[model samples]
Target: MTLTRQVVSFSVIGVCSGALTLVIYVMARDWWSPVVANLVALTAATLFNTEANRRLTFGTPRRRGLAHVQSAVLFAAHYALTSCALLGLGVLVPAPSRTLELTVLLTATLVGTVGRFLLLRGWVFKKAA
Candidate 1:
């Protein structure tokens, strides 16, 4: 697939994943700490994102195991990025509103998405020689 197509697909998947993450995080937050909720959200979204990217974005449906393993590593990085954003928000504003927390998370996720696209293209889903 062309680079443009790959980017567009990745972005579309990312938006869906972001929405999923937000929904899960919001729902899970009622029962768990923010960090734990974030972890749960990220875990689910990352799995969805990885599978979607494997078949749709990169057009590589084989090697599901490797894809998931690599995606797990990426998931860890994303989790750290978003969790730090939430933690920093708490530090900056003790009692921040839910809207504010979501804003920070979305911003952090957006930044992370760019790097993710690069890694997905160049590393995880790259064609073997």
Candidate 2:
């Protein structure tokens, strides 16, 4: 697929995956700390996003073992960013509301999405130019 098409496909999948993450976060928010909730939600979403991006965004037919490693790395990177954001928010607000936490999560996720796509295109699912 063309690069443009791949981006569109990724965006589509991302929207779905992001919503899933948000739902999971909301569900677990009361029971868990924001960091823990974000980790759990993103872990599930990352699993789905990795495979979907592999097949749909990059259109690769063969499985590469490195893909799993790449996905794990991506998730770690994402988690770190969101975790830091949450930590910063806590420091700034002292006691943030759920809405604020959700807002930070969404913003952090967007930043991570951009980085994730770059890594997927340039490294994880690299194709001949």
lDDT of 1 at 93: 98
Structure candidate 2, residue pairs in collision: none
Cα distance off (Å), candidate 2, residue 118: 0.7
lDDT of 2: 0.91
**Predicted candidate 2 versus true structure: per-residue lDDT over 2-96, tens digit per residue:** 88998899999999999999999999897999899999999999989999998889977557567878889989999999999999999999999
User: lDDT for each of the candidates?
Assistant: 0.91, 0.91
Tens-digit lDDT string for candidate 1 (1-129): 999999899989999999999999999988987889899998999999999999999998569999899888888898899999999998999999888988998999999999989998889998977
Candidate 1 Cα outliers beyond 4 Å, as residue runs: none
Q: State in Å the error of residue 21, model 2.
A: 0.8
What's each prediction's TM-score? 0.97, 0.95
Deviation of model 2 at 44, angstroms: 0.2
- The worst-scoring run of ten residues by lDDT in candidate 1 lies at 60-69
